[model samples]
Target: MPLSDHEQRLLEQMERALYAEDPKFASALEGTGLRTRTRRAVYGSAAGFVVGLGLLMGGLFLHQQWVSVGGFVLMLAGAVFGVTAWRRIPRLALVDPRTGAPVAKRRKRGGSLVDRMEQRWQHRQEQQGRGGGF
Candidate 1:
């Protein structure tokens, strides 16, 4: 279920309290990131997908049975990643020159810096509406 306005407001307040209590912790929480536990599943699977794409293309053009088999194997690998680690990685954009992330941009729409960021994220998420749990 989507959060109610009250829940959203409460979350905002809690975020501010958290930042005030410990800026370091707040900074740590600022960006969505993949946990180390999910890294191999994500990156390894991505590599597999790329491999599969290349192999599938080669198999079609070169009439190579081995390449076709490899492509299917890589597709299976990518599926494993989709089910596990894929959800953990945040959708990220090109890095900002100043802070190496688009989020580092100073301009925002809400009262506090963090609130503005949250608002921006929420807006974009709503606009995209991928229907994912993230």
Candidate 2:
């Protein structure tokens, strides 16, 4: 369920209070730690891929089919791991650069194009009424 205006205001106040009271804890709770871990994982995966390449070349030079297959498997595993980790890295842009709080995503309106236009018109009218529309 969507939050009521009062509820949203209350939530915002609570968030601000949390930030004010212990920013370090709040930041830790944020997904930044996960992002960092995923980044490290990506780096590790890249290193693994390089090692796999070296193994593959060594196996070829030694005319070893089993070793060549193992190297190829490692390379495939590393590529998969790196891709997954890269995808898991949270978007930094979604976080507020100033307060380090996550910016709320705008909820998309559920309606037809005409309905959306009408809503936009209403919003513009409200803004003009508030003497801020340009």
Candidate 3:
């Protein structure tokens, strides 16, 4: 689900605070570098696969068994390399830059979705009890 307006504002505020606290760390954790490398890897792998296909066809036409086997191995290697690289790219940076520890490990409360929802509900109740808006 999309974030509510308040949640969006809170997220922006947190991002601003992170940048203010450590601009260098924040930028390093940013995903653009990882994305660029992954993109290059994907493109390179695709090119390799194509070249391997040509080799396979050429070997077949020339009745060269070893060349065909090599081409097949090349194609498999390219696919495996691309897949491993893609999987290695992280979706989120959850580490505390200064501490070098995962954010989840530092939190007192549980980090599961259900636990988070319960915390939110409790927070909402407390706010409402105090005549405050979330």
Best by lDDT: 2
What is each predicted model's overall lDDT from 0 to 1?
Answer: 0.67, 0.81, 0.76
The better candidate by TM-score, 1 or 3, is 3
For candidate 3, give the lDDT. Answer: 0.76
Off by over 4 Å in 3: 1-13, 16-28, 93-134
- TM-score winner, 2 or 3: 2
TM per prediction: 0.47, 0.52, 0.49
* RMSD per model, one decimal: 13.4, 8.8, 11.9
Clashing pairs in 2: none
lDDT by residue for model 2 over 7-31, one digit each (tens)? 8777777766776777777666667
Q: How many collisions per candidate? A: 0, 0, 0
Model 3: per-residue Cα lDDT over 1-134, one tens digit each: 98886995677667657766786778686776887899899888878888888788889999998888888888988888888877877655444455644455233446689989999999999999999975
Scanning candidate 3 in windows of ten residues, the lowest lDDT window is 100-109
Give stretches of model 2 more than 4 Å off. Answer: 1-26, 92-134
